[model samples]
Target: MIEQDRALYRPLWTVSFDEAVTLVRAGIAAAMRHQVKDLLVDTTALRGFPSPGTFQRFLMAVEWAEEASGRIRLAMVALGEMIHAQKFGVTVAFNRGLVNNVFTTELEALAWLDVEPGKGSPTRRQ
Candidate 1:
């Protein structure tokens, strides 16, 4: 996890279902604890595993972070193949009243979050 000028960036590298949920939840928790309102979750590594249950895992994580996540603008980064062309997790989260979006790259995610890379402290606060 990398904290920068306007948001916290979490790059998930081939994480399993449980790890993904835990890490994303942790990221949301950290943002809330620090009073930061933006979060970037890069899951571009999750590609080519076509599973309908994947969305359920995301739903679980999102529900677990319901209280804290609603206050944060969450930006997810994933490859086009990984992202469901329809019924994407981002849209579901948005419909549930969370401020969030998904993009194809970190650059797009950062831009969506209005995060100016290298413009602020890149250190994570304990």
Candidate 2:
């Protein structure tokens, strides 16, 4: 977890599924306290598989945070074990359009946050 320029950047959090919820809760607190507008969560470093409960709680926290502050932008990069979490039954069901956020590679994720989506990207360039 890293904080830069009022933006909280979390490159990696943990291997334990339960720990992930704690970390997310912390991140949400930080974001709320700082009134951060940009939140970058990189799950590329996740090592172990997270259970359905973990994913569910994580999503719940995110939803809560977003509802609390609609201006906050969330970017999540899923890879490896984290990708597996995306495939979990609950994740699959509730993951769609969770946010008006962007899904892309690390570089693209940052770029997406830097610029408004659908303004220049393929999704918007059309």
Candidate 3:
């Protein structure tokens, strides 16, 4: 399942091929609905990777999102080597159009998300 939370406008994903696509679709929908120019996605909970075909489909969805939102800045929180690798592929799939980075900690991710200190912290739970 893919759940988008209001907190930090963050999206959390379950580890599955279908859910990954759902996450991508949901992200695009959320961006369009909110007119968001940036996104912080947390995939630390996802255990494995989606299949190549699933990944491609997600990429296609993201490409369409690019047209709607221009260049969206994305920060992904992927705490471990496995998760980091998965996010790396996602960043690469975004190509050069989007600014994407993967981080191991929520603080770093929040910083990259561009929120200034003292404004409020986007809780990691979401």
* Per-prediction TM-score to the true structure, in the order listed: 0.68, 0.56, 0.55
Candidate 2: segments with Cα more than 4 A from true spot: 1-6, 11-13, 51-68, 80-104, 117-126
lDDT of 1 by residue, 35-78 (tens): 77777777665533344376574674366348554677777776
Pitting candidate 1 against candidate 2, the one with the higher lDDT is 1
lDDT on C-alpha atoms for all candidate structures:
0.60, 0.50, 0.52
> How many times do residue backbones clash in model 1?
0
lDDT of 2 by residue, 62-98 (tens): 5544443544555556554333433342233224332
**lDDT at position 69, candidate 3:** 50
Candidate 2 local lDDT, residue 123: 27
Q: What is the model-wide C-alpha lDDT for candidate 3?
A: 0.52
